[model samples]
Structure formats: structure tokens, C-alpha cells
Target: MIGFLNIIVIICIIVFALSMLGMVYRVIKGPTLHDRVITLDAFGVTLMGMMSLVSIVLDTTYLLSVIMLIGMIGFIGTVGFAKFLEKGVIIENDRDNNS
Candidate 1:
């Protein structure tokens, strides 16, 4: 039934929102760089889940592209942060050499 499905979607969206709030707290209260990075990744996942739920509730496919874009951005950001954590820099500069 449409009503049942809507109820389920609403419940799922609420859960996702609550989890996002927790993730936000972690990001704000994190005591280390790795903790913040992990929290950011969780935030991205929460955003993707919330967007998917919205798409479901709206009964439209328009948000699919947005979901994919978010996923790509999230993955890239996680990888970048991991590299930064490992190497201490995401981008290397050689301005001295250029000058």
C-alpha cells in the first residue's frame, strides 16, 4: 500500500536525520584529525541516504544524478583525506623551485 510505503520511508528518513545529527556532533567534538575525517565520511553517507529517501518519498528519479554526484564527491573526499593523513599534505607545492 502507498500509505504503508510512505510510512516506512518517513521512518527511515527520520533515522537518517538522527544519525546525521550524531555525526555532526562527532565532527564538532572530534579530538583528532582521523576522527574528523571519519566523521566527514559518515556525514557524506548520511547525506546520500537522506537524499535517497527524499527521492523515494517524492516518487521521482530526478535525484538519482544528484545521489551519484554526492557519492563521487564523498569517495573522492575520503580518499583525499586518507592520503593527507598518511602523507601530511593533500597537494604538494613547488613554488620555491619555480622561483
Candidate 2:
């Protein structure tokens, strides 16, 4: 059973690596900001999957915190990029009006 599990994990890692390569290509070759942002988000998701697989193979949960941190960072980055695309900036300049 452990052998079968190992094989599955190895296959998953390979698939994630390939997907990450594709995402990198898109990030580099994409014609628009939105496309690049989407690619980055996809890359982050693939990274998270790979991390999970590694933790599983190692039989340790020590990477859980790292995984969560990566997820949050990815989410925030995506949101910021999306907002930038829509408004040309992530944070509005409310201070300018107050002054």
C-alpha cells in the first residue's frame, strides 16, 4: 500500500511540475496584465499542491504553516493585481483628498 501511495505522489509531483512550467510560460508570454495575473495565480495553486504532496510524502505536517502562508500570499497578490488592472492602483489615495 505504501508503495502504491508513493507512486501516486510521484506522479502528482510530475504533473504539478509540468503545469508550473506552463504557467511560467504564460506569465512570460502573456499579452496582457490580466493574463499574467491569472497565470501567477495558477502558478501559486500548483505550488501549493506540490507542497502538500511533499508534506504527504515526508509524513510530516511541519509544512502546513508554510502552505497556509503561501496560500494567503497568493490570494492577496491576485487580488492586488486584479485591482491594479481595474483601477490602475491597488490602494486608493484617500489622503490626497483629506489634505
Candidate 3:
């Protein structure tokens, strides 16, 4: 049972590494702003997966807190970026536009 889990973990790690390369390619060769955003998000997702894999392999939950923190940070960042693209800023300065 442990051996099977190890194999699965190894496979997941390899997939994550490949995903990182794909995300890097998008980051470097993306021709559009949305593509760059996608790449950045993909990288973040991959990192979270990596953190989970590490948690499994090491048989400890010490890294889970860091993973959750990253998730919250990523969500906030994506929201900020989307708002910036839509309104040219994150924090609006007008009472009328506050929603």
C-alpha cells in the first residue's frame, strides 16, 4: 500500500513539473494579456498541487497552512488584477462607482 502511494506521488510530481514548463512557456510566449494571466494562474495552481504532494510524501501537515495562505493570496491577486484591467485601478476613488 505504501509503495502504491509512493508511485502515485511520483507520477503526480512529474505531471506537476510538466505543467510548470507549460505555464512557463505561456508566460514567455503569450501573445495576449489574458494568456499571461492564465499562465500566472496556472503556475499558482501547480504550486498548490505541489504543496499537497509534499504533504502526502512527507506524511506531515506542516505545509498545509502555507498552502492555504497561498490560495487566499492568489484569489486576492487575481481579483485585483481583473479589477485593474476593467477600471484601470484596484481601489476606486469615486463614491459612485463603489459597489
RMSD (CA, Å), each prediction: 3.4, 2.2, 2.5
TM-score per model over all chains: 0.86, 0.91, 0.89
Question: In what order do the candidates fall by lDDT, top score first?
Answer: 2, 1, 3
Which pairs clash inside model 1? none
- Which tens-of-lDDT digit does each residue in 1-99 have in candidate 3? 569988899899999998899889889999987778767877887899998998999999999999999888888888888888788889966887756
Stretches off by above 4 angstroms in model 2 are 95-99
Error of 1 at 64 (Å): 0.5
Give the residue spans of candidate 3 off by over 4 A.
Answer: 96-99
Cα lDDT tens digits for candidate 1, 17-90 = 99999988989999998999999998998899899999999999999999999999999999999998898898
Q: By how many angstroms RMSD does model 3 differ from the true structure?
A: 2.5
Query: Which of 2 and 3 is ahead in TM-score?
Result: 2
Query: Tens digits of per-residue lDDT for model 2 on 1-99?
Result: 579998999999999999899899999999988899999998998899999999999999999999999999999999999998898988996886966
Q: What C-alpha lDDT values do all the predictions have?
A: 0.92, 0.93, 0.86
| C-alpha lDDT of residue 4 in model 2 | 91
Over 4 Å off, model 1: 92-99
